[model samples]
Target: MNRMNWYVVYTKPKWEKKVAEKLNEIGIECYCPIITQIKQWSDRKKKVEIPLFNSYVFVKLPDMDRNSVFQVSGVVRYLFWLGKAAIVRNEEITAIKENLSNTNISDVCILPYKKGDKIKLETGVFSSQDAVVQEVTNTHYILVLESLGCLLKIKYKKDTL
Candidate 1:
């Protein structure tokens, strides 16, 4: 029997929940972390649940069954890293769950920074890498990885780092 590994699936914008639901209905184990936020409109404010990671969802299955996920709607493809399917360790998933469940941590805010500021990556492939801020955009941070000597642009959502 093949062991299951957690792999990230890229989804169409705003489709993370639907895709995860479909996968679950099909007997596939999937996780899409959600957070509740209050959205303010011109008139009123309302609470909404949103995925933690935009366009991304995690699914666990054997490598050979990776293709099965494609049958679900809104699943674009599996995220790849270094020419192979990006595998997320079980511990990382557990950490995310634990962190999210912790009520003491109300919010995680990234301080406003300007160019040339030294910062350490908090997550993703370059987690813990020291990088210099190259440019700041409304949606992303163009960073120069000091140790790797490469440039990377990471997109950020308002509530996430």
Candidate 2:
């Protein structure tokens, strides 16, 4: 039997929790990458945890039995590249664990953001709109927008936008 390495699984939109629960119940080794986010809503604002990527999840499985692993619900497929099982580098996995680690995590927690990426706030009045992250702070973020020739800086809760 081929030894298992980590493989990426594509899950349906917003089905990560269900997939994870089913996998764990069946004793499958699976991982869902998540991060804490600053959430904003109409009534109130709060910090909430959410998945970094919406439709992608990871599973530790051997290449040969990939078919058997695919039978899980909400699991679309295992990622492949060059006709072989694509490997998620150890550092990538480590980065995830390090982000999720509660011990000493406060010092390390960040938005997992990249420069020049469009993000939508999943909740709040700003939800469903595209905004550029100007700067990130512990509990809030400096959001920016360009309308014609003006720069707007608004302090938005970390998870809001």
Candidate 3:
């Protein structure tokens, strides 16, 4: 028998929670990470819970049973990486759960840096190194290291710059 692994499911826009609930009703293990944020209107502000990863939910199932997710409403497809279904390790899921449940964690806002902006690396081996922003995608920042004449691509989370 195949062991279960976590895979990301792409859902219809604004349907993460609905998809998760439907999947669970069918006995599939699913996780939808949520975050509470205060939204302000012209007159009043209200707290809302939103999915941390937009249009995405994590499902735990064996590789052979991956197609079962399509039975749930709003499920579009599985997230693909390098032409195959992307598998998220158990450790990553645990980390996300722990981080979301931690009360001390604060909302992190990513700085809006444009192409050609100069920035310094803060956490990696190239700490203190200067690099120019080549491209900024939704999930990654492509940087050109001037001194080393190389390119570095960094995948970032909501909490990191």
Candidate 3 per-residue lDDT, tens place, 20-135, comes to 99999999999998887789999999999998777889999999999999999899988876677888777556646765675644442223334477887675434555668777
lDDT of 2: 0.58
Q: Give the per-residue lDDT of model 1 (tens digit) for 95-130.
A: 557655655444432333334778876885447656
Instruction: State which candidate has the highest lDDT.
Output: 1
What TM-score do all the candidates reach, one by one?
Answer: 0.68, 0.59, 0.68
List runs of model 1 lying over 4 Å from the truth: 108-161
Q: Write the per-residue lDDT of candidate 2 for residues 18-132, one digit (tens) a residue.
A: 7877877776777876766677899998987676556667777777766765667898876665575567655446645643553333322323333454577576434554556
The number of clashing residue pairs in each candidate reads 0, 2, 0
User: Any residue pairs clashing in model 3, and if so which?
Assistant: none
What is the clash count of model 3? 0
What lDDT score belongs to each candidate, Candidate 1 first?
0.74, 0.58, 0.73
Candidate 3: Cα lDDT at 72: 90
Record all residue pairs in model 1 with backbone atoms less than 3 Å apart, i.e. clashing.
Answer: none
